[model samples]
Target: MKKEDLKKLHSSIEANFKLLEPFRKNRLEVIKEYVGSHFSDHGSEKQLPFNMIRLFVDIFTRRLVANNPSSLVTTKPLRLRPSAATLQLGLNHLIEEIDLQRDLETAVKDALFSVGMVKVGLNHSASVEIGGVLHDVGQPFMNAVELDNFVCDMSVSRWEDMTFIGDRYRVDLEFAQTKMFVGSEDAKKLTATGKAVQDNERHSTKELLEKRTGFDAEEYRPKVELWDLWLPLENKVITIAAGQLTDVVLNEIDWDGPELGPYHQLGMAEVPGSVMPLPPIASHRDLHELVNFTARKIQRQIHRQKEILGVASGGEGDIDRIMNSDDGDVIKLDHPDLVKDFKLGGVDSLNLATMVNFMELFKQMSGNLDSIGGLGPQSDTLGQDKMIADSSSVQVADMAARVTKFTARIVRDLAFYLFEDPLINLPLVKRVPGVEGVEIPVTLTAADREGDFLDYNFDIDPVSMSHKTPGGQLNKLMTVIQQVYAPLRPVFQSQGITLDTSQLIRSLAQYADLPELDGLFISDDGEALLDDQPVGSHERTLDPNTTRTNIRINRPGATNSDRANAFVQGLLGQGNDEQRAVAARATG
Candidate 1:
């Protein structure tokens, strides 16, 4: 890490921040309008600006994000190979081996920061008063569309516990403010090199640094909390300064940006389409204004609905007399001929129609009508509803997939760092078809760290992706089941073939996301079914909870054929006696 290198990253910060001027300005207006309180009242005395429309879209944006990860990044084990066996027994072992889910979740969050951190250094230790008060949990989280907001004063989410350097002193992720828009140039430079840049005037970092050196303080600045002032200097030296008020470079290293890029900011996905870095929020400003005007007009009409009278001259008492609420009230006027009357505003269906037209136009312009669907069950066909619900999920998943590439790359490079350590110890796992799993104690060699030793990949979870509740997983499951397994079913059964239920469950889990799928021969408490015996004396019920409980049965004695038969029986039981008789005869 050279001073020139740190300076290069700083230069990138400045150039990128300057370039983001338009996006920064535009995002403020969008979020402002979305929050429904930041608009002008158009100089009118009647200030009735309805924010219903913007609020709807605001919630919609978050819903899009909340809908993301489950579909956008499948929880199914992110494998080292695409076609690897789930039954390999060692695959799940590999997931535990790599600590995939926990690390990857945080990594995804960091990747998000990296995108913003590249242009505007991320505020790792930053926290507002409201802290984790999320905009909308219903919407997607860490969405790329909200990237502009993250760069500005908008407090979006960040990855927690993401440190790239070695453990003892390295703090990967911290809460800090983005110095690109709000802090000093030196602070911004400090931030570019993966430091937690913050408003140092208020923290204990200054005292800690000074106290460490046991020097009387005068010439120093407060750095971020829990962080030593690690600086990269021009002579290709990176140092961890340990003094309070002076630079005492403790440890320095010679390193390139490439080695650190993956470790530091491995994942950050940028919002797509030009104007580059301009979010979808940029397009909705005009539409918000339009809706604002429409609301104002509606409010004006309400005010005008009251009868207004004018005269050549009238006192306050006279006006009050005219405004009397009595059913049979009369008022005296000196100038009868001078009296002028104005009634309520006329019915303008055209304005209402115009507002609807504008709304449609806005949706079309923004291309966000994917969330709008028919209210009645008959309004949209099943396929049409599924298409509408899954469209955004699909698009969002694809966008995140791009970010996954960087994450994979960073995780790959981390192998060299982790494996090179003498203390490193990981089980060497190998898959053998039709064989028992074995773990061999293995030590890393220099050769294993030199090349692309791992080939990990990602796939989106389409099954867990749909926007609707209850039916999303089922919908996707049914679809893939119909396409992939339905045709194979008759053929397999006719040829006396069978499918591995666990393997099928794993494959379908990518699309179905059924919690019940994990219940295969396992109790609700997660104990093996074979290990459990029913305690009939515990809580006996004279009446069954169902017409029959066969398909629902998962006690110790139930077998695959019994489950299948129970499902068929339950279907027949749902019908009348005649149907049941026919079913019984057919089965016999």
Candidate 2:
């Protein structure tokens, strides 16, 4: 990289950062609501800030957890084959191994707080050791980049049309010299381009803090600003030193990672005619201010003491004594009408009512946070309340969908890292689809994964990504059992296809959100069993030396319904054998 080129890159980076000043300020304001910052108008005392922004964002974050791989992202094979099935299983386990859910929680909070953007990148040289030998392991990581630390082309209207994106971060001077620039000879002699250098003592973060937060860090040790600019057209990433060092090129490397240069952008609301996005909180800013202002006003109104005056007709001694009188204290007056007390009202009920209205409006505008949280005024019946919750979930659903799409893109990059590497090999297990108590161990080698990267379609299970309570899961399961299975079971039985209850349990347990219920049947030994099998069962008959048990026939005593009715009786040791078994299973 030439010094002149480095100068141009540095200038472009600074200009882009300057273009994002308004967005950065907006983010800082929202962050203040999160951390509870003092207002400029308020005095030295920190006035209580109504953080409805934090409240809503946090609630929505809890609602957006990708609790499982099926919830995060799914890879669908273009061609239906055994290889593709194996590949899909590998990808699913990879999602868990990487702990994408936890990273996404961190990223989702950042997106809600800022302009709603998350970046995905691969770290190829992550340090690990095997038998005392250090190895560089490749892995993908996601970042919720700070608003002030990132810059993009402002002239572009679409993300795809944007020329470049860059990240700016502070690096310790000693670390940069000893670690980053140790092997490079350019550190000894700095090349100077014909360009003015930015002041080493100042950066936007420090300046923004001093201006907005009134905090000074002048005594802190100096650090260097490092810039990583990704050029999509060239498919390369370049690093440069900012601050005191003007137009100093650090390093440049080819980016064979994602086509868009290892960085992906995600946002909630779309901003017309701009590549940048409008955060959901930005829309709620005005309402948030109104709420806080009214709350403060109401607080002051209630805290104010009532004014009382005494009209004295005679000596003022009695008036003073009467004004300062405690309980059971009596004051001697010269005349009966010596002093008259006049009291004024302290607070108005109207102010408090208005404040409540403002808060309600804030919640309504921000996707009815109160209703979603099961608080405030709700519908008369359970169904109506559910309807209201469903209606309010629309906005939160949209946010979650955006996260799902963002996660899909990240998963693609992660898959690329795994499939593209010929050296990557993984030992995995895939459960047989219809077979009960069966999982086959398989190994996926580079040869198995070698193919066009576009062979799989990426999908995100939006419904799964949205969290549900245990009660909700149970309700859903019951609905499926009653509405679908119950109606179709007889029809299938007539066609000589009897429903396998054990298989049904295993399949449902694999995907159901109820972990405790699944644990009841899926034992610690990795074997799934609803109950013990009788003698001469298929599992026991597999042993050639095992003797076959004689079959015995008996008259049917009670139907399933009768046994169900007798379950309680069986618990009291008064019912038949079948009813007792049913009761035991129920209790177990």
Ten residues in sequence with the least summed lDDT for candidate 2: 193-202
Per-model TM-score versus the true fold: 0.45, 0.72
The regions of model 1 sitting more than 4 angstroms off are 1-22, 38-253, 256-276, 307-343, 368-380, 383-468, 477-489, 495-588
Q: For candidate 2, what is the lDDT?
A: 0.63
Off by over 4 Å in 2: 38-46, 66-80, 126-136, 171-183, 187-224, 307-343, 434-437, 492-588
What global local distance difference test value does model 1 have? 0.37
Error of 2 at 421 (Å): 1.7
271-389, model 2: which lDDT tens digit per residue?
A: 89988877778788777777777778767776775666665556566666666888897767666475566756555555554555666677778787866765443543456567877
